[model samples]
Target: MRKIDAADARLLEAVQQDAHLTAEQLGAACGLSPTAALKRLKRLRADGIIEREAALVSPRALGYAIMAVVMVTLDREDRGVIDRFKQDIRNTPQITSGYYITGDADFILTIVARDMDEYDDFTREFFYDRHPTKTFKTCVVMSAVKTNGALPVHDLAQSAI
Candidate 1:
């Protein structure tokens, strides 16, 4: 695994909380000057430590208020089937997140839709109609308790040492 220092950890944590923070702000937060902060950030990006930066748009605001978590089981675990399913998940805009998981299910998916009808259509087209999918269960989210993607950088930095 790649190693990172305490200052790097601080910068990552701070930037995750607010990606728009200026170099000066990040520097002040992480005990580095603006130039040093910029350099470190550049190195981090060049090293692929920082992935894509994006704004988190609300589903409700976008008129896609319905969200569901689905667990899926496949009929076969062959490489071709898995790859095709993964490709479908990647291409489908409604499927916000998909994971090839263990235990009772083969895959877990988080989907968003404008309403129940759209969600049903998604299930019918993506799960029911898909050849690889044997069975699937869905849990429509009533309310989201939290939706943050901040990593525990403090713990990560400590563990690296």
Candidate 2:
């Protein structure tokens, strides 16, 4: 990965917060001309500094009232088992995010469902029958305090420099 300068970092901050920001607005936010901002934007996209911009959809609004954090421990940690598990996560649309974390659990997943029964069904389909998931723990979210995944680009850049 390439290092980002101050202006580039500022532009990233603004764009991540709101992808709809025009060249003029981004330039104003980052103290650059519209032309300069546009140029930087193109470079950022080309360099993969800025990945695809996507809308943050709410699962609650779409009748997915159940949100769960599932910590899974597989019986075996072989390459085949792990690959199959990862593929399973990708195939499952209800599993929004999956992380191979460094902890007691082999994998962590963010799962959404319409209700309790749906979530139970998900566990049976995903864990019980599919993978060699030895044990899995579920933590139902009572409240989502913070969900917007905006990075602190400007601050990180300042510290890095």
Candidate 3:
């Protein structure tokens, strides 16, 4: 990885929070001129330090009021089966995020649905009818106390030294 100086680090932190910040604003935050800030941002992009920007959307506003975390255990020694299951999970729109884990479960999935009834339909159609999922468990999220998109830049900067 490319080593980032304090100014670059500050720019990254500020941009992660608000990518819409003007070059002048970012410059003011980092004590650089607007032209210099723009140049540094360009270099960051060229070096792949800045990957992409995205807008975080609220699931409730999008008609998905329930959030669920599902742990899926599949039959071992079946690569084809695992791949098929992954593809099926990816194809389902309700599944927002998924990861293949190294622990007790083969995969973990984060899902969003309108309500319990919608989740029930998803479970019956995807888990019961369509796939070869062995054992599974789900935990409904009562509340998300804290969430942030920012990376731990301080820790990363320390480790890089």
Candidate 4:
């Protein structure tokens, strides 16, 4: 791993908050020349500090009004079943995110659909047919108080020592 100084940490924080910021703008914020700033940004990417950048899309605007977190518990303890489930869920676009967790559930899935009917159809056709197991769901994402893709680089830098 590359050693990141205070300047690099500041640059990372600034860019993560707004990737669209130009090198000159970022330089001004972090106390570096435009040329130096661009070089540092390139170095960060080369070091794998900055991953691919992407736009955050709203689910509501995209026709997916319903958001649900489904906890799936597999009947069998076989690893093959879990592997198959992971692959199947990856292929299914409705399941945005899935995690293999500990406790009562083997996997937790985050799903978004047009409405309850669509979610029901997905559960019946996709989930039920492939893996027959017990599931518990919680449907309350009333409001997203805080959602950020940015990581806390300052804290990470402090801890690196």
Evaluate all candidate structures by whole-model CA lDDT and list the values in order.
0.87, 0.90, 0.83, 0.81
Could you tell which candidate, 1 or 2, scores higher by lDDT?
A: 2
lDDT of model 3, residue 87: 88
Using TM-score as the yardstick, the better of models 2 and 3 is 2
Task: State which candidate, 1 or 3, has the greater lDDT.
Answer: 1
lDDT of 1 by residue, 88-126 (tens): 999989888899999999999999999999889878887
Model 3 over residues 64-113: C-alpha lDDT tens digits?
88999999887553888788888887888899888988988999998999
Clashes of 3: 0
Clashing pairs in 1: none
Number of the candidate with higher lDDT, 2 or 3: 2
Residue 44 of model 3 has an lDDT of 91
What TM-score would candidate 3 get against the native?
Answer: 0.85
Return the clash pairs for model 4, or none: none
* TM-score quality measure for candidate 2: 0.94
Quick one: how many clashes does candidate 4 have?
0
lDDT string for model 4 (73-113, tens) is: 88775988888998998999888888999998888888888
Task: Sort by TM-score, best first.
Answer: 2, 1, 4, 3
